[model samples]
Target: MGHPHRLGIVGLGNISAAYLDTLADSAQIRITAVADLDTARARTLADRLPHARALSVSELVASDEVDTVLNLTIPAAHAEIALAAIGHGKNVYGEKPLAARMADAREIVAAALAAGVGLGSAPDTVLGTGLQTARHAIDDGLIGRPLAASAVMVTAGHERWHPSPDFYYQSGGGPLLDMGPYYVAALVHLLGPVRSVTGAASRLRGTRTITQGPRAGAVIPVDVDTHITGVLEHDSGALSTITTSFDGAATDAAPLEVHGENGTLSVPDPNRFDGETRFFELGATQWRPLPTAAGYLDSARGIGLLDFIAAGPDRAARANGDIALHSLDVMTSLLQSAAEGRRLELTTTTERPLAVPLTAREVWSQRE
Candidate 1:
């Protein structure tokens, strides 16, 4: 292999640890620098890595030691950090939604394209066996022709668990924006890009009290809608119904379900890396568990970055910027439709990402 990609990470928040754990022993990549709003936090993390140093966010993005920026910052900071990395001629891979708004998302994509740098987004969980196996089934005609799907995510709220859950209720953070990316990305993988959307939304309550963490018993204001329902019309003519809520206590609904001409497929939660995919044929008496047949087995958060690097000069990364931009467009358009009380056509579209062939842990753990 050639030189490992030098990674400079911005944002040392909750999700950062998961990525660190996934990439700690990688041979194809190296963590060279760390940065966060809290210098002490960045220093603490960098101290643990023999080859890494703590730096300010701006310094890290401009440093000669870094070739790519792994952005784990909040949604509001996503575009800012990404643009800085792109401006310095470095590739970027960031947490979902691409950015807090479509305009920023477009600017980031355009900047990366103009700078000739690769850009990637997260919720790479779809690259795992759970979603890929189901996609494999659909592609192999096990379900004939897919006609529709349903994605449901219901939770009381995040304040009960997350100490810094203020973002969950902020403008860029809502039940739909928080949890919708996983399901929407998975739907794009299972079905195809959405062409139009119709939606309705509501806010359940004005305030919520934190039940755990340092902020336990503290009340926070709710600004965005707590419940969101929408219909996505896919380019393939498949229709999908989606419901995301922070107002509910719990639900037993299959996290996702796809129905086709000859059968129905029950997909596991898209937020997870792997789970059992069950199928019920048109005439079958019961649902049967489908064997895992595709994707990176035992993969985690960093696999998407590895995949982006491995994609080389020949093809787009499965989690490339276009898919992310389109997904965000679909989501934002849904909310816009809700506000306008009318169906809205999407302004962007993308080809369905290439499928991941069944791959083992050892095979995908390193860059191909």
Candidate 2:
């Protein structure tokens, strides 16, 4: 615990910069190496980082200096990179959806378990104030006996601004897969685990044109559904209806809203680290913003890793792979339910992660 845990980052994409921003002042972790298929991009990050060296993916995962591999690889390659990191006997954490498929996610989990290394995943946005405050309200009984919830994410899609938006429409990419993790993770935090799901999905367009970024005017193929809606039956007797769509332009939908026996909680967007969390009592006329009463306030991307690290070897990390797998299981089942036109029972289950107390960032880093 005397030295910062050495982090080897694989995949230096747009998101990598945000993680680097969070890691800059982190006492719990430090970037020791970075890798990307774009070698020059890796070199660029290495130049800007205080002590990071540019290495090949293989080298970075195997580097003796690295204690954990912070995998930011695209969804399709998530398992390959994670399995490789675990093979090297290093702990691993990555971006959402765990992998392109549940099978790969299962493999990733199995390998990490066998290797005895820590496994964690993202949409760590749940570890932030927005979702945590809402959770605090429910746990505090401000919202009595949670009964139902809704998670909505509707947009025209990422091709509008992303330079290369090909992945968003690919087999591993879809509104449900790309954006559902945040909502699903947040829902699990609010209402335990999911037991089953029933879904319906549709696609009205076959192709899309990139409207912005360097690849403007480029046409991308659409291989997945553009619109998806589903109902989740949580084990705790709470039902959640979720809709994730790239086909819609806008909506008045709250990012998330949880209704209980006595009150309704309008949660903030789980895609971000912080925001206003609004709530309304049974007889209240209007919703009110809840104070930041739990979780890490004023935080960002890599805090998940910090939180995971803070949990130590003997404790369970809130963002651990078990929950990510459960979330992915829920999302994939939604798609399956859509195709089969029937509700699907989930094959995985996970406990609600322990709540984050209102601890200062420095204190988390200093924990044993």
Candidate 3:
């Protein structure tokens, strides 16, 4: 390898720790700089890395030592940080929902293309053994022709755990926008791009109290819907029903499932890197767990970044910008469809990303 990609991280939130943990031992990337709105937070994390230094958000984006910016900012700030990094000609990989709005997301994608910079987004979890194995099975005809899918995610609310859960209830935040990206992204990976959608939504509580962290007992206003249900029509004619909610206390529904002409696949949670992918054939009496047939083994949050950088110029990253934009469009259109009480055609679409060939942790970590 010529040299490890110099990485600058722009957010030090709860999610950042997970990425940091995953990238800590990577040989193909180096944490060169760290920045956060809270200067102290950046300094504290930077101090833990021998070669890293803390910088202001502006400085980090423009740093000569940095080649790529890992953006972990909240949904609302995604475009701002991404645009800044792209403006400085840095490759960017960020947490999901590319932007809170489709207009901003399109502008970000346009800016990156104009600047000739690489862009990627999260829920890279789909590239892990769990979802990829499912994809492999689908593609291998283990499930004949995929006809439909269903994804369900239900929880009381994030305010029960996330300290600063305000963002989860804000304009750009909600059950569908926050959690739907993972499921939608996975659906796109498994079935294909969505052509249109019909949706319905409801906000169960107007206010919620924080139950954990420093903000425990603090009440926050809810500005967006807490529950969302939708049916997606994939370009390939596969239909997927989805439900994401902060209103429900819990659910026994499987995280994801795909039905085909000859079999049914039970996919693990998209938010997780690995889990059991079960399948039931047309005449089978019991579901069987599929072997790990594809994707990164023992991977985590930052694997997508590694995959993005490794793609080089030959192909788009598995978690590239186009898919993120399409996922965003699917989600925003769902909300719009709900509000309008009608099915709406999506304005954006992307070819299903290439499936991740089964890879070991040691191999991908050292890959260029």
Candidate 4:
């Protein structure tokens, strides 16, 4: 485990480039193989990475050179790829929401446990400086006994710029499921596990047209809710109101915030690795920036995967299946509650994953 965690990437889409940029300099992982349903795409990516070979999806998942599967596939295919990798006795670290369905995601967790391999998933943005600073503030009582939080994400839609936008409108690709993971994960980090939720949603448009890329002006039908608003009741007695949408133009809401008996904190966007965390105490007249006291420095997407593997054999990965599954359960229940017109109690709950103290890559990926 002292050496790099050889990675077999299963998707080579737009987002894969961002990951490649991070992996280029990582100390804990390196891409050894690349795969996609589009063989040409896989080959093209492999050609660029040093020593990375192109493989079929099945081949990549089972390759002897690969230790973990990096799943960058679409939301619908996440579970399928993960199960394949886990079945081959490889660890898997994937993009957010874990999987599209609760049952499917649960299967990945169960299989990983059965195989004795670790499980992990993203928005490891929680392991970054901005949120970690806020968490430190909470732990230090800068925010006295966290009382509540609110998370908001709003955009007209992704069709304005994305080339192939069909998946954003499909069964697993609504604003809540697609984008809610970041907000929900951050909320859990800030406020702890959610116990129940009551949600209401709206879909103001039936179809959307792509305004950018090769498929410009191509219309896509919308099947899932485009605007979702809900409240999560955390097990710690903290409450959070969340609103995620692809229907609105914009809003002035902070991406995230936490309030407590002593102060309030304005958190940076959870989708990013770093930003300023602002705080305003009860007696203060102005919001001041908190010094970055924790988390990875200048971290990037793949760093979370490094952190996951660096957790050693005994400690759970900082971005783990239980937390991801809990996040998914909260989101799915919110949408279900909206559909059923009732508050739904969650069956899943996760302990807050251990917080990351400020550390460099070398120090974190080491054995004393």
Candidate 5:
């Protein structure tokens, strides 16, 4: 509605730095205000931005100068912040794990729909050139008729680096809910919405030790699932084996691979913005990197927000919240399936319009 979108950021945590760095040079959105439960932290971030003021959550949400609220709060706060922004007639872009529960995520969506305002969520990794290129190749029939896929993500635990890692072991921050969105979102973009899901999860580590940082040598209890493996049945008749762990060692596990009738498309780590994706034909001995029409130039958050804003008010807006909710449903089914030892059926389907194309220059120019 204005010359440039006005952005009001609600949380000034470590992850918020990434968004600030990316927005620093953008002309599309200006940081008008910032807020955090810790007023000092909010002030710190605001001090670094031009014409940005630190304020309370209520003030930020109620500010008429702010057109969009970037909900960077913790997982438990996502639904509340977004709902408040929507209630105030402001567009909202929330961080991942949209909400702690499926019902809450649905409520946020419903509120946005009722308010007729824009709603988006993050872990926008799917928009990266790596995944987008893979999507394009699959759609172009380079990997005719997807048959199956797999994704594996592992970390010793976040206590090593995160100043406050206690939440990661809580309900909203386990391996399934924490890292599952990135992989699941990519799968949805490539394969389609899941038809069913079954999973087996366990607290593989009784306690986790911080390997580095000031917290080194500190041990923390692992209350949630530290290891989870699941089977996803997609509407396209493709099966995806997904797994995540906070208790495992490192390996050169490919992030994702789609087996198709003609060949296999191996996608680089979906969590990143740029990488070479390879396609191996049935008869070929080697995997060849597919030529990208354009380079991915946006930061983790920039691409999704830019696209949503670029689509303008008339077009159907795409955001991470939709994918986050679907991912939550899949994870919920996985937990249920694991308990019952049977596949859980999913009623929703994943479908999107054809992807916008990018020129090679556009794709390559964005690389750091």
Candidate 6:
């Protein structure tokens, strides 16, 4: 390892803890500062690290000590924080769905390109061995030529468990925008970018009452579609059906499956790092399990961050900001297609590459 990169993290929300806990053990990057609208929360996170301080967003971005800014802020603040980091001449790594709107996402990408700084986003979940193996199998023709795919993501609404679930029903917080990144990213990885899309969406319920956490019994109104179904036409002529909902009950199976001419590949749950992969031959009797491989150990996000740090300024990886923004566009188009009742066309595509081979130490190391 060379010199460690200094990191300043913005957003001390619920998900920030997962990233911080993983960064605590990595020597490649160091958290030099943390910032949040809630100063107390920022201090709480800062206290866990040595030589780390809690600062305001402006201070964190303008400080010369920071080389990179991790934008863990909500969807609404993604563009603001990311653009600020770029304007301050620092690299940036943000959480998924780069921005709430396509125009904002495009602006962030443009700013990063203009600054010539490293910019990336997550849902890095595809880097997990589960998806990697699936990609490998697909490429190896174990599944023959890819023909079609189906992804279904359903939830009983976040109000039941999240302390503050108001954002989930909003424009940036709907099922397609919030959870669509993972599925869309995986699809882009496996099937490439979509050429067109058609969809239908609906609001399952007008209002939802919190049933768990501190906000229990609080009712939140829904303004966005809670249920969405989309048909994606891949450039390769392959098609896919993607459906997401906030009104369904839990099921044992995953939400996505890719079918090919030779076999049907059962993917792991899109939301998880690793699960199981089953292959169903054209005329097979039952689904067969594939060999287990090294998957992500620390919530999946760490994998992309580590890769970014390792690669440094030399080369870019699959989790680059452009790919993330493309995925966001796909999701956005899905919603637009639903509204217009017309097929939406896309101008970008991403090739699905084989997973990076795992080294011995990487496979053995366990999170403390």
Kindly report which residue pairs in candidate 6 clash with one another: none
lDDT (Cα, tens digit) per residue for candidate 4, span 165-264? 8998998889999999999999998889999999999998899999999889788899999999999999999999999999999999999999999999
lDDT of 2 by residue, 1-368 (tens): 22688899999898988887788657677788999999999898899878899999999999999999999989999999999999999999999989989999999999999989999999889998888888888999988999999999999999987989899999889999999999999999999999999999999699999999878998889999999999999999899999999998898989999999999998888998789988888998997888899988777898898878767766799999999999999999999999999989999999898888787766654432
**Shift in Å, residue 166, candidate 6:** 1.0
Q: 2 or 3: which has the higher TM-score?
A: 3
* Candidate number of the best lDDT: 3
TM-score leaderboard ranking: 1, 3, 2, 4, 6, 5
Which residue pairs in candidate 3 have backbone atoms (N, alpha carbon, C) closer than 3 angstroms, thus clashing? none
TM-scores for the candidates: 0.98, 0.97, 0.98, 0.97, 0.93, 0.94
lDDT of candidate model 2 versus the reference: 0.90
Question: Which residue ranges in model 3 land beyond 4 Å of their true spot?
Answer: none
Candidate 6: give its CA RMSD in angstroms.
Answer: 2.1
Instruction: Return the lDDT, model 2, position 124.
Output: 88
Residue 7 of model 5 has an lDDT of: 88
> For candidate 3, what is the TM-score?
0.98
Clash counts for all predictions: 0, 0, 0, 0, 9, 0
| Weakest ten-residue segment in model 5 by summed lDDT | 359-368
List where candidate 1 sits over 4 angstroms from the true fold.
none
Kindly give the stretch of ten consecutive residues in candidate 1 with the minimal lDDT sum.
1-10
In order, the Cα lDDT scores of the candidates are 0.92, 0.90, 0.93, 0.89, 0.79, 0.82
Error of 3 at 331 (Å): 0.2
- Ordering by lDDT: 3, 1, 2, 4, 6, 5
Looking at model 6, residue 330 earns an lDDT score of 84
Cα error, candidate 6, residue 279 (Å): 0.7
